[model samples]
Target: MAKKESYESRVEAFLLPLMEENHFELVDVEYVKEAGTWYLRAYIDKEGGIAVDDCEVISRQLGDWLDKEDFISESYILEVSSPGLGRPLKKEKDYVRSMGREVEVRLYKAIDRQKEFTGILSAYDDKTVTLTMGDGSAQTFEKAGIALIRLAFDF
Candidate 1:
């Protein structure tokens, strides 16, 4: 577990500068094994949205750096891409950016006999998140209680 985290941290450290230089927001990075294949994935974004070309540019540059550094001993596939529309709000930046947008918040345990709520995200602090529900009522939830929060999509 510690080794996995160490590799993830190293990868994030190496990618941060490259993302900054390319004007991309470093959303998240993960090192995971699926179907017996190791994968190192980097999720990036920008002001509007990230393009395929943007991913290509970052991928090419970061790939070169990774090759030079040779930090990971195991073979892994590297992927650079945008965090899609329903990406989880995991960081402060994500919450800030999501303010005034509709979001679906799921709790670790039921609150008011419900485990999920959908509303416009009104405010967020380190400790809590406030949402304006359909009936014009405001509800504030402890951040620690939330299991997941992501943009809500209407279809």
Candidate 2:
């Protein structure tokens, strides 16, 4: 595996059981470099929501495990938190839970001269996602061209 993928996978493996035990859902795990610093972040959630205290509890435990395992060679900051309202649909369960919800879809390339669209998430499969727009039209996008697909929220 690539270094980034390996780090994410290892972190996820460590998080899975901890999540189940705590009744939290693992939303996503990422190992990414922003500017020059690498960050390993885990986003978690539950039926109601997540709070700062929840994040603190997971962070301490995860930090301890990472220290003991010492698998990552590079310096990285560890973060555990809830995936906020705009978090993307990154996994199967994310899609499952988001069905019939309004979502914003951003594409890597334009389709019909537009690259971003907001609609009710109607259907999704391994290869595509279908959204029903306000105009009563359904837009189906190939998964490969999607840059981000996330729940839509407004202030």
Candidate 3:
């Protein structure tokens, strides 16, 4: 597997249990280097909405746990926040939940000669998402084919 995948796996393993215990959903994790230091961002979500207190609490606890584990040697910023309105669909469950909703998807490679599409999500199995395009055409995309998946801004 690629290094980014490995890093994401480790981060997910380390954070999921803690999130479950705290009644928060783990939306995503981004580990990237900008300028000089590495940054670790954890996107989180909960019913109703996430508050500042929620982010602060998770940040503190996860920061401590990350320090104890020492999985990352480089200096980094640990951020915990809500996924927001255009939240990404990162898991199979997420895609399933988004069925019938408008979505914007960018593919790793072109499908039918297009690399991007904005349409209504028709269905999602564990492996693929079927999108109905503006012209009433449908296309199926394996999960691995997506570069990014997010809610579309209809307005």
Best candidate, lDDT-wise? Answer: 2
> Please, what's the RMSD in Å of model 3?
2.7
Ranking by TM-score: 2, 1, 3
lDDT of 1: 0.92
Local accuracy by lDDT, each model: 0.92, 0.94, 0.86
Compared with the true structure, what per-residue lDDT tens digits does model 2 show for residues 1-155?
89899989988998999999999989999999999999999999998899999999899999999999999999999999899888899899889989999999999999889999999999999999999999999999999999999999999
Error of 3 at 142 (Å): 4.9
Instruction: Return the TM-score for candidate 1, rounded to 2 decimals.
Output: 0.84
Candidate 3 TM-score, true structure as reference: 0.80
Q: Is candidate 2 or candidate 3 better by lDDT?
A: 2
Question: How much is 41 displaced in model 3, in angstroms?
Answer: 1.4
TM-score of each: 0.84, 0.96, 0.80
lDDT digits (tens) for residues 1-155 of candidate 1: 58779888888898889888888899998899999999999999998999999999999988998899997999999999998988999888888889999999999999879999999999988899999999999999999999999999977
Scored by lDDT, model 2 comes in at 0.94
Shift in Å, residue 146, candidate 3: 3.1
| 17-110: candidate 3 lDDT, tens digit per residue | 9889989889888888889877789898888889999999989987888888886766787878898888988777687778899999999999
Candidate 2: list runs displaced more than 4 Å: none
